[model samples]
Target: MVKGIIAYIVTDGNGQDAVKFYEDALDAQVLSLQTFGDMPENPEHPTPPEAKDRVLHAHLRVGENELMLSDTFPGSSLKLGDQVGIAVMISTPEKTKDVFGKLSIDGLVTMELQQTFWSPLYGQVQDKFGVTWQVSTLTQDE
Candidate 1:
């Protein structure tokens, strides 16, 4: 099973702008970039052409962890608040299941575990103390 901390999501009103700022200010590298409309293989994913310029995914290396950036989908009510849940991305189905099960105990399941086009396993839950988590198992060929 694959094991590693992939990255942390940083939501921003201007994702590309924020990434650019961080790249310049912190001397960070833009390891990879993926635009919403430019997503390969899945044509029915609903990423509008207008969002082609918006960052769907981006990676900037800072120390040991990669800081991921993504623009909020147009019309999405979700916004970055004072409290943000750190996503724990696993890379295998086994790990995802294990983590999900452990977290589910005494925790509230915000989103039940399910397979997504983007990942093999994905789920969200709030632990007993109310800390939110986003867990995923890599299905991306990369």
Candidate 2:
């Protein structure tokens, strides 16, 4: 049985930047940061020299949520799109607006925050790291 599900992001070489962005945008705290070089060398799982400085693992506390991420393995890449989205249910419209505004700064806003049939305030945006977010105010009936 699973205890919980933590959103994990894999970037080509932007995991560090993503962690910093989340820390600032969501006011999240970085619990742990590890680089590939921090790991012990293994014959079957060797760490590439060029990838040594990349993020091997990162753990963050986004508000009360847990988020983990890592830079892709050597010779790998990342592509973002509508495949997945991280949804945030805040306690107030103010937070929804604030988070949306911060995350949408250098990205795209597909929906403006406003009163919706299902929520008091709801919006969708793609942050600078190419991560899509759905910010909304938690409702009673949800």
Predicted structure with the largest TM-score when compared to the true one: 1
Total clashing pairs for each candidate: 0, 0
Q: Tens-digit lDDT track for model 2 on 1-142?
A: 1124456676778778988998999899999999988887789978879888899778799888888777876886456654346767677667677778898999999788888655798787888898877677877654
Top candidate, metric lDDT: 2
lDDT of 2: 0.77
Where does candidate 2 stray beyond 4 Å? Answer: 79-142
| Cα error, candidate 1, residue 72 (Å) | 1.7
**What TM-score quantifies how close candidate 1 is to the native fold?**
0.72
Regions of candidate 1 where Cα sits further than 4 Å from its true position = 40-45, 80-83, 105-112, 128-130, 139-142
TM-score for each of the candidates: 0.72, 0.53
Can you write out model 1's per-residue Cα lDDT over 1-142, one digit (the tens) per residue?
Answer: 5355544554544778888888998889999877776676465776666677778778788767667767766766554451356567777788888988888899899789998666778888878777767788876674
Report lDDT (Cα) of residue 75, candidate 2: 83
Q: Looking at model 1, how many pairs of residues clash? A: 0
Give the C-alpha miss distance for residue 8 in model 2, angstroms.
1.0
